[model samples]
Target: MDTQVIVLSVVADIVGLVSVILGFVAEKTKIKPSEIIVNDFVYCDYPTSSVLGMAISASLMLILAEVLIAIAGSCCGCCRTNAAGTGKSVVGIVLSVFSWFAFTTSFILFLVGAVNRGVNWQHLKIGDDCPLSSHLPGIFAGAAVLAFVAVSLGTAAAFLLAATPGSSSQYAQGVEMGRPQFQVPSNGTPPFNRPTI
Candidate 1:
C-alpha cells in the first residue's frame, strides 16, 4: 500500500517482463555451426543451451513473483494480519532471491562459455575460414544485460517489502490501534495502598 512499495513493485515487474522477453529471444536465436573437416571426419561447434534455459527460468520466476506480490498488495490492502497476503509477500521475496542467484550464475556461465568457445575456435586449424557468426553471442549478451537489470530491480523490491512496517507481524495491527495509558493516583500512592511508611 505504501507509495515506495508500489513504485518498486511496478519497476521490478517491468524489468522482469523485459528480461523474460530478451531471454526468449536469446533462446530462439539460431546459432550457426562452424564445421571443421579433417581427413574424412567433420566436427561441428554449437552454443550451450543450459545458459539460455537458466536465464529463461530465472526471468520467469522473477516475473511470476512480482505479479503475485502486486495482486496480494492490491487485493488485501497490504494488511500484515492477512495470512495469505503476508505469505505471498514472503514467497515473493524468496522467489526474487532465487531468481537473482540463478541469473547471476547463468550470466557467469554464459560469459565463461563464450570465452572458452572463442579460445577453442582460434586454436582450430581448418583449411577454410570459420563460418561462425557473432549474432547469437550478441543476442545472449543482450539477454544477460536484461537479466542483470531484472535481478537488481527484483532485489530492491524484495528488500522494500521486507522492510515495510507491520508487514511481517500479526500483532502490528493491535499496536497501531494504540494502547491504553494508566493514570497515576493524585495522592502519589499506589492504587492498592500498603501500610503507611
Candidate 2:
C-alpha cells in the first residue's frame, strides 16, 4: 500500500504497454519476403523497413519498465528471513528471475528481428535468397508476448515486495499483554492518577 510502490507499478505498467504496442507496429511493418529483390549475385535489394526503429524503441521501453519494477521491488533475495515483503519471498524471487530471463530473451529477439527485417543485410550468405525471412511476423509477435510476460511477472513480484508485513513490522506492533492504566477512567474515580509500581 506504499505510495512509492504504487506509483512505480503504474509507470512500469504503462511503459510495458507502450513497448508492446511498438512491438506490434514493428511486426506489422516488417519487411516481407516478397519485397526482397535478388539482384543477380550482386546484392539483395532490401527495403528500408520501419522495423528497426520500432523494435529498438520497444526494447528501450521494456528496459525502462523492468528498471522501474526493480526499483520498486528492490532486489530478489529469497534467502532473507522476512518472507512477507521486499526481496525475501520465494514467489517474489521466482517472479523476478523469470521476468529477467524473459526480458533478456525478448530483447535479443527484438534486435535479431529488427536485423532480420532487412535492416541489416545477410551477415553470412548461405544460398542467399533474401536469407530466409525466418517467419518475421511470428518472431516479433512472440517477442511482444515475452515482453508482456516479463512485465506481468515483475509487477507481481513488486506487489509482493510492497506487502510491508515482515518481522520488523510485527515487532513494532509490540506485545499483546495489557498494562496497568494510571489515568482515571470516565466511569470510575481511581485512588491515584499515577502508578505505584
Clashes of each: 0, 0
lDDT of 2 at 158: 78
lDDT over C-alpha atoms for residue 65 of model 1: 45
For 1-197, candidate 1 gives per-residue lDDT tens digits of: 45555565666666565655555554454344533333333443444444444444544655564455444343223444443445546665555555556556545534443443322233343455444444345555555555656455455545545555556544643455558666779978766667878
Model 2 over residues 1-197: C-alpha lDDT tens digits?
67887899899999999999888878887777787676656566677777888888999999999999988776643322355444436677788899999999999988888775545464334474556656455777888999999999999987876674552223334546578657667879785668679
> Between which residue pairs do clashes occur in model 2?
none
Candidate 2 segments whose C-alpha is farther than 4 A from its true place: 40-42, 77-88, 116-129, 133-137, 167-197
Question: lDDT per model, in order?
Answer: 0.50, 0.77
TM-score of each: 0.37, 0.72
What does the lDDT come to for candidate 2? 0.77
Cα RMSD to the true fold for all candidates = 10.6, 11.1
